[model samples]
Target chain A: MMSELHINLSESLKSKPASDALGFGKYFSDHMFIMDYSSEDGWHDARIIPYGPISLDPSAMVLHYGQEVFEGMKAYRTPLGEIAMFRPDMNLKRLNNSCERISIPQVDTEFVLEAIAQLVRIDQEWIPDGEENALYIRPFIIATEAALGVRASKQYMLMVILSPVGAYYPEGIHPVSIYVEEQYVRAVRGGTGEAKTSGNYASGIKAQEIAKTKGFSQVLWLDGKQHKYIEEVGSMNVFFKVNGEILTPALTGSILQGVTRDSVITLLREWGYTVVERVISIEELFEASRQGLLEEAFGTGTAAVISPIGSLSWGDKNTEISGGVTGELSQRLYDSITGIQRGKLADPFNWVYTVK
Target chain B: MMSELHINLSESLKSKPASDALGFGKYFSDHMFIMDYSSEDGWHDARIIPYGPISLDPSAMVLHYGQEVFEGMKAYRTPLGEIAMFRPDMNLKRLNNSCERISIPQVDTEFVLEAIAQLVRIDQEWIPDGEENALYIRPFIIATEAALGVRASKQYMLMVILSPVGAYYPEGIHPVSIYVEEQYVRAVRGGTGEAKTSGNYASGIKAQEIAKTKGFSQVLWLDGKQHKYIEEVGSMNVFFKVNGEILTPALTGSILQGVTRDSVITLLREWGYTVVERVISIEELFEASRQGLLEEAFGTGTAAVISPIGSLSWGDKNTEISGGVTGELSQRLYDSITGIQRGKLADPFNWVYTVK
Candidate 1:
């Protein structure tokens, strides 16, 4: 896959911010990766250039029709002074599925990995060197065709950008309040819910904002049809431990198959926990909470490996979980995932792909 | 509304192709309308700039969260050689509603129209003269804030680009084959379905492409829940003539309320026809077709004023309507709408908002 990635260094570089002060996606690296796609050439001309503004036609399909897909991962400066990525294969694999749903051409996984590894190695200085900090990697593809009609674009741009960031929780892994949203559904079966696309994020924003005004950090979405089943929490896949059995929504064509969700499930099963992937309706969850059997609840995503749920408000009722503190299971999962990511713990699953 | 607009003419104007060769949104006019918005200042800095590429940071919210909204309309060359816009206020009003749904800042309707008028006037030569050829107006607002968090953007850019488009159907208005889709859903209740945003269109492309491959010109979308009732056809509001009364899908919070759909309803009622807006299920439509009572079917949209549906394919069953030709009512509706648009007919309804 050595297609000779042309490198163009920036003549003037912006000063890198302190890793502790860096928020998510606030500061970018000096260099980034780009690959172009067209009907004739397909994906070609892979290059690494200075991070700057990307010029697009005003009528680009991505802006008008939203034919875009993205994935989120992280690059960490391991304890051994090596920069490594955590399960980038999972993110890229899911990205292909998202692209397929939108008719975007499938990317060469090996080629993309090669490009990402090279880019991360070149911008190794951006990777934060702390237990709570890492450089976030955002790989995205957008329809670049400047057309107005409702059709698939003949052109696309696959780009990879790196951002230095601190921990997702500024005050460490604390439980955040969640609003149980019944008015809006995140993604329904037979929709783009399982895919990592921009449209899904766009549609869920108003609900998220409303939840914020209600003193919640995120919104817990229900099923689109019945609005009875628990779908996901904010942008992460949710898990609930009721009566010592961990339960998460099954992949019913609508819930995103988060990498962190998959990792947590594997780790829980390995640790002799009964993890079940099935539909847990809202009524069942509320009943469990009422009976004081809801032992633990958390969300899993790339940004926040494990976000504990302290409270959940549904209409007039608000239920406090784990006594408004991080659950024991949630803390263990976050510690193990972050430890494995930073090479402080042994990678039994070989999930960490180190960059030379 | 009387704010002064700053104008920046292009140093080198790109030549436009012939009207016959001009397809939809392929080429742009010499000038375009631009505006900026922020949470602090609201929408301001209205200006007319040369049609060129727009530069956005890689972390723009529109690229990730997809907080974007747009409107589709046309600037017409009236019979008296005046450039007029048909119900543009309606389009802008709907755009505002869409922005509200997605949490984007709304632009002043009057100020936006003023900018559009000034830009269109400056690029007046780009407007086509024939009935089938007119300048397509695309007004869009995108989240320009450079951040990766899944929240509403603090900054936005509103731009209107003009494209000289030929007739929707180069030959003439004719009947199109439609595929009744049950596999994928476009929008669901309490979602972004009613909003004229990019996600709704992005989610529908795969279904649309599959329909095209199945030898159909458009895909008729059923409701997201249960996939029972008819929702829309190829991004257009659908109407069916059952027995003697006209039936269109009621606004169930999942169907886009189209401007053309409204105009058609008004014209039908004024002409003493029963236009009922109610839920039209697939079973009822098929039953009507079997009973020889399904008189006609057509889709109403801005792109194509009236597109007659000739044949409908549902699963293994196929039904031909109106003897596989354009119906009389469809032809009449098309004539009336186009006539009003071009000022060839009386403006008794005052639907067309003529630009001075």
Candidate 2:
């Protein structure tokens, strides 16, 4: 079902030279990819048109009911100046998982990958050639049907938009301070937490804001039930190092199975590190930190390959992780991931997908 | 601060016959009220424009990140043929509370109410004169800024759109079957469960669909922690009658404080019924049903004022309530609330806010 995509290239490309100087998701390329889905027509009318406004009915299900899911990846510029996407298949799988959870129709992963590859290929010039810069790719599906009823939509729109992003950390990879949110939760068991959907992110905004106000970069959300177990951060999967062993939250239904998080875990195991996935209780983590067993903490996501945690503030206690700097393990994980992405390291798992 | 609103009404209106109707959130009136807010301009560019497409940047926060909140109310036609809105001030206050939680800028409640009134007054003819028919009002705010970073949006849009709706149960108030969703939780403590936001509703779609497929009208969500306590039904606040006492989930931070839910509580208390807002454990409810202490169960929302629960299926256990018919308390509460809204009974509580 490889239909010819209607390509409406912009009359002229507008260059954003300073985009590399800005942070991620602050700038866009000239064009975007869009495809419409209806129960009657399936997925049809694919197009790559000028990046502009999308007119949606005010009562569109996405607006009122939040029937939407999205994927986040990047188009990386290698040292050879060739543009590629890292593990797009994973994003496609996650996107479908999110769609299934949200009751949206499952899109063919092959179709989505082909569309995305073509999109990045056409917008190749937008891929920033820098250590920390790339073209951030956001593919989202929204319910466009103009009905306010609390039911699945019959019509939907799947779109892929490119943003020319600078470094995720404009000031370089400095360890961040994270606030332990004891009140607000990001996801619960049997919620859309495992899916790359918008609801989970939306729910975390308040807690994230509170974290920011308290002088933290992001929130460390606990499980919704007892608020005692560790879950994840706002947009990333969390990992902690206890006694030189790496532990992350298991896929217990409430945490997003991030592509970066998965890749990091694989690379860690490949490097002979003890990577464990299980329910990490907050009480255990706090005790471990106090006992000097908790060595490091970091979060993994597409935007930030691995963001090191400098310190954690939960309740009234603020504890520094590995002397409030990036630990050796955190640095190694970041280096391996970025090195592979930047073509500095050998691609052992064949994770990089060239945009051609 | 009342800035002059730019009321740009649509030149033409699309009129639909009174008999042609959908349940809710389907057909829209000709015009809509919109206002734009930016960090620079504050809140400006308020207008009543033709109901049409809203152009948004591909990287708009709401599209990808789900930084959105909304409120639902209705405009009714009194016997004097005057269009009136229910307690809109309550909606406005709740909207602001949601905005504050999500870090979105707050709109003036008076401004919002006046704008809603203006829109409803302009679309007064669209309000169906039949019983239980009115113009459903959906006021929503979305983060319109075209940035993908995990931060609050600097720009926002506050808009009110009206849709002409028929009775939710056009075939009369038939008892609805509800499935006990022990696996999928709608919200958790410390989440946006209480806010009238898009993410909270989006997370419930899958659960609702599963219930629907299982021959139920809605899914009764459990508390995210233990999945033991009954929280709410899809989109509506839930209620239970056990041993002649009306019981509901307290404001435990995971359930929406529905206006209809609050109104029902008030009406029940004034009607000399024992009402309690506390955690209602699912096990207790099931045990009560077994012991013949559970008398009735229902859901309350603006769309479905009060829908009787015929039966509940949790895991392998199936329980029927009130012989699969409307219970006496359900009938009395429904009659009192609907009677007040439909101008059939005395509203001593002054719950109705008459539109000027």
Candidate 3:
């Protein structure tokens, strides 16, 4: 746990991308944080090195078996030109939970946090200077053991990379259309739906692509057990304001516990808005929309803090939500979170952690 | 597809392991088969190269999204010193089917077959001579693009590796005890369960590990939607001889279409055994077992052609089948399949394909 951290600067650093050209996950910083783990060494040799390729045996377990987990956070540049992060502790804890679910070894959260902060400070220039533009940090652990077996790996590698990303919505807070997926499922209640493992993501992409083809931005997955209960929309936790009460699917071990979703719930509760976490079936939601009770719908995730849902198409039935625009609640939640992240608003919740 | 294949022999070929010490997936051949695929060039540069590591960027799609598929087959040494493969064509076609499900580009089946055959012919000496010993061939494809978007990857790599493996049952062909998994669901209808994708395997492994802790050799999974219908046993297709009639769970999109299971059904049908595929619920199975109609049970997969199920433990209920010994049908199926694989019996269905 007390491994000495090493930094090896790149001989020739690459130039950062122009702020306007940055989209998401495309341009990376010069340096990355990495660590290795084995049964004997137990997570040793923490280092920050020049970003480059990682060679693995073709028979590595991560490639053959999807034994990998990742976390996404961002470093925001405040109005005073200082770097800040939002509830990184929550992300780190969730990462460990994901590792436990998939049998990956748990890492020291404090040490990993320190390493991440150090890495971000080293490449602070990559933090793009634009509203909503932040240096997106991706921390991932992969099973690096060189074996073809379908079991847990004896060796693992943790690497954290930084990318300068544009706003999730390029123009502004526009609404996203969603397709209710009935054919394919993301996860069941007793599956890796709650875990941030690669398998869950990989298995769910086909449905997302199908939605894209159907002119929708994301796929709203139903429960695997019955294809009735609303599980999630793409990689985000879904929410709806039916009869003026915010309702989201409960954490039933089949959906990712989104940090932003929790924050939204907290803020809504504080604002005297009724919030409920219970199983909401697709039938009930559509019927509510038909009766004009479904006031507003949205999705919450770390990547896109609040993605307002404009429409949901299930089979031949299509319903418009929030008048195909960002709802008032979606707007407020986004503003408050982004404001605190950029040091524009009062940090009463103490969610922001300044690195510089 | 007409690209000339490159051959790079190892500087010093590794020594072969002793027959008895050849564990599963432990010792690999000196060379491996590989091919590259990109959006511009669809699956080109087929080659046989020295077994080595594959360097990937930390942001490779396969690391984040489990966009990977694999196939398992074995090469057997005939009594006349000729090497043979069991239904390589079917395995290749199934690999394409899995690729289709995972959004991976399909490779030319004949070209890949030729590549695999060439590699096996080159490493023919590694094929063990023991009755149950053969070279286990693993063909896998993985997403190689270095991006973090949750869409299909533009770049992919396909590699094939061979390992000299001893018998799955090192001691003898014995019956296995299984724990019926009702807590964790593996797959549901309209999921990747039918495809040989890494996510399906990775998500299902936690249950397998739990069963291992309970001293069961494997996990018999029920359907994901309802924890009632019998689905599969570990990585194999399950079958029960109920009242002298062979029955297996139909391919209802959640159960893997095991290659060995199909062969077993074909052989049984040819031998005048009434083989039926339908939905079999756990309650029905238990009732049949109680009434002694479930005389024998077994699992079928490429690794263990026929793994007889001696006992099934579900919750507090445990029942023993076939007096805890290999059933007559199970023993005959194993003997018939292995005999044909080892070139000891006459090839009636023409499954044995000798490498040129």
Candidate 4:
């Protein structure tokens, strides 16, 4: 699949950042992957070019119409000193789903996977080995047409850039406070909510900023239709443990299906825990807290495998969850998932794709 | 305000497109206006440089998260061989409102108006002098910070580009067929519908494409919450005349407050017509058609001024509006607005801003 891939290495590679100082998405690797799509050529001229600025026409449709989709994955340095990816196939599938929803052309998944592997191999030395540190992989496509119509662009550019990072949260694995937002809506059914598109993220900044100003680390979004049902926490899929049962919002065409979320659910189910995927309202969760039945809560995504919720608040109601600390189950799930990703634990689910 | 403005003229200008051949947003003028924004320096270093491609880092936030807002207005060559703008202050004011909604920094509207006047003065020849011809001005701001974090950017670039446009619709002045979209939602009450941001436009592409497949010119979006009430017709604000009353959707948070829509309402009210701004449902519209009370229907925006709707369809119901032709009121409104815009009609409302 990479037979036609062209390589253009950087003339002077960037100095690697200290592992301890590597904040999320700050520094880029020396080389990045790029592919172009046109109506005539159909995704031709795949190449690895020097990581640098991309020149775009001022009227490029992506800048004006938000015609873009992105995927976030990571490459980890294993215990044995080999690089591996955690469920990259899932990311590729989700990327295609996003493309279908945004009316952009989908890439061949297998071919794209091979491209990722080749790029990672060339920049393998750039991957950091600090605790919870990995090479953050960002694969995004933008409409590159120089025209200004409302329709989909006939030209597009898909690029994959690698960024070395420490942790998604500034506090690392500590539990964080979340505010339940009722004012601004993120995604609604029949909208671009389920897709991993830029518009969904753009619509979320105001709510997140409000939560931030209120001293919350993230905003727990309610459904757009009624603003009652819990949809997602920040950019991740959320879950709650009440008594002995696990609850997660169903993929009801508005919530993004996170890869780590699926892994968490599967792991819990395999361990004989009952995980329910249904519409969970904020009122029900508040009532559960009032009854002293809400045990643990967390958000799951690629950036943070498991972000435990220490405190939750909405309107005038606020409560500390799990005594404002990471719960036992949250720690265990994080260890198990990260362990599998780092090749330190047994791969019972065949989740890790080792790059040769 | 213009003291700090710097001008860098292009060495060579491209041949202007033939007035008849000018399509929407196809040809760019020789020069464009640009301004950079940083948290520390504020919006500074405003300049007019040769129109060309802009260089952006691969991880620019706008490319990944769609942090962008844009405005659409035109520079018209009036009958007196002078340039004029139609309510540009309104466009700039709305641009600020869009910036607030998207968490982008707001530009000084009065200062930006000077910037637009200077840019148009430099490229005044780009304004085509044909019937319904104007220099389409697109002013947009994009987040330029090159980072992968899902947050507001600290750096941004605001740009103004000019394109000689003939008409928004290829069919020109004819009534268009509209599909009442129920399966795909454009916006909900708490969404970014009222803002002139990129995400809203991106979310509408799929529905528009589907409508095109069904032989419709555009999609008439229903409310996201119920998918019952009419929100917008294509990208424009919609209006209907039923039983001698002019009706348009109210300025709900989810509907764009178009400058042209406001103008039409004012003109109708001045003509002693009772114009009602309230919620109008698709069921009510169909019932009006059934009872022979449905009259003229059209969409209003900066692009088309007034686009007459000939036929509308939803589910199994299809009806011809105004006997499948342009309504008398629609034509009269279009003529009155365009005449005022072209300096043929008396400026009773002081809507035209003459550019020196």
Against the true structure, candidate 1 reaches a TM-score of 0.99
Candidate 3 error regions (>4 Å) = A1-3, B1-3
Which of the two candidates, 2 or 4, achieves a greater lDDT against the reference? 4
Model 1, span B52-146: residue lDDT tens: 89999999999998999999998887879888888988999999999999999777898888888888888988997666888889999999999
Q: Write the per-residue lDDT of candidate 3 for residues A185-300, one digit (tens) a residue.
A: 88887778899988888888788887888799999999988889999988999899989899999999999999898888988998999999999999999999999999899888
What does each candidate score in C-alpha RMSD?
1.0, 1.7, 1.3, 0.7
Indicate whether candidate 1 or candidate 4 has the larger TM-score. 4
Ranking by DockQ: 4, 1, 2, 3
TM-score comparison, 1 vs 3, better candidate: 1
How does chain B score by TM in each prediction?
Answer: 0.98, 0.97, 0.98, 0.99
Could you tell me how far off, in angstroms, the CA of residue B113 lies in candidate 4 after the best superposition? 1.0
**Tens digits of lDDT, candidate 3, B1-356:** 43578888888899899998777787889999999999998888888999988889888899998999999999999889899999999999999999988888988899899899999998998998677788999999999998877889999999999999987766567999999999988888877899898878778778888899989988999988889999999888999999989999999998888889989999999999999999999899999999989999999988888999999998999999999999999999999999998889999999999886
What tens digits encode model 2's per-residue C-alpha lDDT throughout A1-356? Answer: 55667888899888676745767787788888999999999988988898888988888889877889998898888878777688999999989989999989998889878988888888888887677887889999999998888788999999999888776767667799999888877888788888888778877777888778778998888888788889897688999999989999999988888899989999989888999999998889989999999999999988888899999998998889989889998889888988887777889999988776
Measured by DockQ, the strongest candidate is 4
TM-score of each: 0.99, 0.97, 0.98, 0.99
* Per-model DockQ against the true two-chain complex: 0.88, 0.81, 0.78, 0.89
Model 1, C-alpha of A106: deviation from truth (Å): 0.5
Model 1: residues >4 Å from true position, as ranges?
none
Rank by lDDT, descending?
4, 1, 3, 2
Q: In terms of docking quality, how is candidate 1 classified?
A: high
**lDDT measured at residue A258 in model 4 versus the true structure, 0 to 100:** 93
